[model samples]
Target: MKPSDLDPVVDALEAELRPYRDSHHTYRRLPSGGRDRREILDEMRELASREEAKWRAGYSSGAVYHGSADHIEFLNEVYAVNSQSNPLHPELWPSAVKYEAEVVAMTATMLGGGEEGVPTVCGTVTSGGTESILLAMRTYRDRARAERGVAEPEIVVPVSAHAAFDKAAHYFGMRLVPVPVGADWRADVAAAEDAVTKQTVALVASAPGFPHGVIDPVEELSELARRKGIGCHVDGCLGGFVLPWAERLGYPVPPFDFRLPGVTSMSADTHKFGYAAKGSSVVLYRSSELRRYQYYKTATWMGGLYYSPTFAGSRPGAISAEAWAAMLAFGEEGYTIATKALLETAAVIRAGIERIPELRVLGDPLWVIAFASEEIDVYAVMDQMSARGWNLNGLQHPPAAHICVTLRHAQPGVAQRFVADLEASVADVRHMPGSQGVMAPIYGMTGAVKTRGTVEELLARYGDLQFKA
Candidate 1:
């Protein structure tokens, strides 16, 4: 659609969502006087109540991974105790240091590190998966510069890899060579090998890609990088916490961690499968020597001395505390049992998708199930599903939707409800004969715009609505 046509659509969306922005309260700045504590808490509770039902009822995908009442209460107490703690001030709060160190160490061992045969993996706790990836990419860029004397560094990445890699490339002033995946959505070994030039500093693979939920050819990709004497990072942000337990549960999970001789670094989200609260992730390296490049230390600065392991200078120790508590709260057995239930639930959902004649799953995925429709517009199906209160993930390139099965979906009758709703959605969408669904124009604007700046303008305008009172 042209700008004139898009204005109405954007306007309607903005108007409809405006209530969410300024429903009960609108504060551009602090009030003249402090409000009553009881009134503030009640109003905050009222606002939060409007958005809690859908996620709590398992109508969403991947946002709230673990949403049990007991778990939330426990984590809340943990947060309350150490709310003021900061890892930057380790001298003041030594407990934060202990928690951060143990979180990293425990996560390292989880990903086939610190074993007898495996090299000792060492890493620091990052804010989230994006930070971990950025840290790893920067580490590789610096190492290649210092050791190999390569001025212009580059990273060979599969097209299916996370966008964080692209962001890392952009932020670190490196080139990202995108290699297309094969039919099964695994990275082509030959293509990856061919992409590796002298300037290639590192190669990346995803363990169970976010789009298709299929693990890349990490074993081969890492080996290829090894032969080239370059770093190979496994972006396991989505699957690291689940794959180990899946393998232990007798499911076939490929080797995509430090156990592989060529694998140099990995990033895993504690918030996702570790059942920890948000803002916690682990970035692992094969050894401390390699991780040394990721650190930033300055003694000649005017602010006395400064050192930081990750991007942020002063990190929230409370998040690290939550990660530690979650990990200890759920040990190997806990994960194994949860994975068994989660995978079984996913099996049911996957079978349901297979049974629908109009839809075909992209690949054989264990938990994160993505599917497309040849007969109907998949985005229209997404719109219909959204009408039914399903918050699924929509993707381009192939144009599909996926539901990342979580513990919330393992709740009573949630899987059955999803299947029934999905089948109904397909039936509803199958009758539409010709034109694209209501959302076609929006996606068309994304793909059809000649200049990327036009889309950015629309996005910036839309973002402006998010704060309107």
Candidate 2:
């Protein structure tokens, strides 16, 4: 599209992103006096009432992993009890220490750790999956510098890995080598082997990538890592909580954790499928010796002896408490049940997509489902799905769309409605003549924009519009 085409497309997006601007009061400056507590609560509640139903009724994809009212209320209670707690000062609140320690232990145990006389897997709780990935990458970089005397460190990551790996490479000033996946959308082991060099400190494989929902050949990748004497980090941020239960339920989940000799570290999100509240994740290392590199300490500081395990100095202990509480509430039995419902729902949705003559499923993904079509415009179909209140994700590269099936979709009638609405969406897009949706032109022009600076500028401008207040 021309520059003129992008302007109107951006204007429409700005309108949708700022829907609350006209309805609510914008606080550009402080008022002389504070508002009443009840009035503020009522106003926030009113907005939540208008917005909660989309995810509540399973119209969304992956935004709300476990949206049960009772679970949310339980997490809220846990957060409330530890609202004043901060993990930075363990002396002030010993319970915060226990919460974080147990959270890490439980997560590690779930992912092939916490056994007697094992390699002694240990880790620290981070803000989220992004921070976990960043911390692990930085730790490996620093470890290489100290132990191997390699000043210039690099990490080999699959192209289908999460964007956080790119962010980690940028922020840590390390080289990132992207290896393309095979036809099945999983990482190609031979290509990854070629990408590694003497300077390579770590290798990354996603346990079910974000875009295509295909797990890489981690067994082979980890074996390669073992031979090359480098660390292997499995990004289980998406499938960490669900895959173990899925395997127990008879899904063919490959080994992607510390059980393998080459697997040195991993990251998992408690906020996603662990049913915990947002803002909690675990990054585990094979041993406390390796994890020690991730910590920061300085006795010479004027601010007194300081040490922070993760990125943030004063972290929210309440979120860690919520994660711990959530894990205990949903033990093995609860997770197995939730996994059953979620997988069953996902199978239905995937089959429904396969039944559509125009659409083609990307891979043999278990939960997250991506489908594309050579017959019709996929973004147009996504637009129609959006019109029907179906919130799905749009993919690039091959131009596809996916839905991360969660407990939200396990609700009664949601799976059936999604299939019915998707069939209608494809039909509507098939009959429609020209590209005429908000995303249609945007995606079309973005795919055509080969200039990196132009694409960055366009995205930056769109993000700026989101903050117009």
Candidate 3:
């Protein structure tokens, strides 16, 4: 739809959703007139109860990895214990340093770092996956500018790579060159090699990309970058905590980590699969020299010499402690068992999807699977699922949907419930001839538009809706 057409649709949506939006608590500033603490806590608990079922019952995708009540309680306790600790002042809070350092070390070791006298494979804890990716991209841009004298640096990334890479390119003043994936939904190594030029600073590949959950051919892409004397970044944000354990459980996992000779940096999210509280991830570098480019140090400041390793100065030490506690609590054995259950559950879902004649799985994914329907409109199917209390992710371009299986899905009958709901949804969508569901029009608009500006404007308006009250 054109801009003029979109205004009416948006107005209609706002009118329909205004009641629910008004009651939802987007922020809770200290109760002005002094409400009881117990009352406030109860209100928050009620909100959580309202939002928990979609994720806890395995109807949602990839938001909560380990959603057990006991695990959350333990992590919350860990966070409470270190709530006052600050890593910026190590002298004051030595425990914060210990937690942050150990979190990085453990994450690095999992991702094939510190294997062969690699100087302990140094890194720093960041806010989340986006910061980790941003730091690595900035490091490559700075390294290329200093060593290769490439002023206008560019980074070649697969079309399946995370949006964070594009954000990094925009923030760091580097050109982002996106190469398309092949029919199998993996990055095209030949196209990536063709896209690289003298100005290219790095090549990026995801262990298991977010959109379709297919692992890129990192070995081939990184080797190409190596031959061209540029950096190679392996994005293991979604897979870093699962792939190693999956490989140990006899899954056919590929080489997409520091074990590859061409991989110079990597980003891994502790908050996602590490079962930690949100706001923690690690960014590892092959060498201290390369990581130095990611640091910020200035000596001539009036506030005394200022230097920070990651993006933030005074980071949340509590989240760092929670991440450390999670890693140590769930040792190698704990992770292996969790990964095994997750993959087994995913297999069940995958098999069920394949049995349905209307839909087909995208790729040979382990835990995260994307499926598309050749017979029916997938978005309408997604809408049907949503009506049945399922919150699945919607994909464009090829018009597909995905569900990232977690430990919650491994519960007794969650997988069976998902399959039943999916079958029913497909049948409902098929029966409702020419029904344009809620999200169908939006997805259609996105896929049919030639210029992205219209889509971006719609997204901006969508963002504006969040602040309506």
Q: Please write out the lDDT profile of model 2 over residues 82-150, one tens digit for every residue.
A: 999998889999999998999989888898899632449989888899999999999999999999987
lDDT of each: 0.89, 0.89, 0.87
* Strongest candidate by TM-score: 2
Residues 257-284 of candidate 3 have per-residue lDDT tens digits of 8888888888889999898989998999
Each model's backbone clash number: 1, 0, 0
The residue-by-residue lDDT of candidate 1 on 1-469, one tens digit each, is 3666557667766865775664566678899999999999998898778878989999998999998999999999999999999989999999999998898888888899875436579999998889999999999999999999999999999998889999999999999999998888788899999999999999999998888899998899999999999999998888989999999999999888888999999999998999999999999999889999999999999989999898998888999999999999999999899999899999999999999999999878899999987788887788789888998988767778899999999998999999999999888877765434445445434334435666676777788887676
Check candidate 3 and list the clashing pairs: none
Models sorted by TM-score, best on top: 2, 1, 3
Which candidate order results from sorting by lDDT in descending order? 2, 1, 3
Quick one: best lDDT, which candidate?
2
Question: Candidate 2 — what's its lDDT?
Answer: 0.89
For every candidate, C-alpha RMSD to the true structure in Å: 1.9, 1.5, 2.2
RMSD of 2: 1.5
Lowest summed-lDDT stretch of 10 residues in model 2?
441-450
Q: Considering summed lDDT, which 10 consecutive residues are worst modelled in model 3?
A: 441-450
Estimated TM-score for each candidate: 0.96, 0.97, 0.95
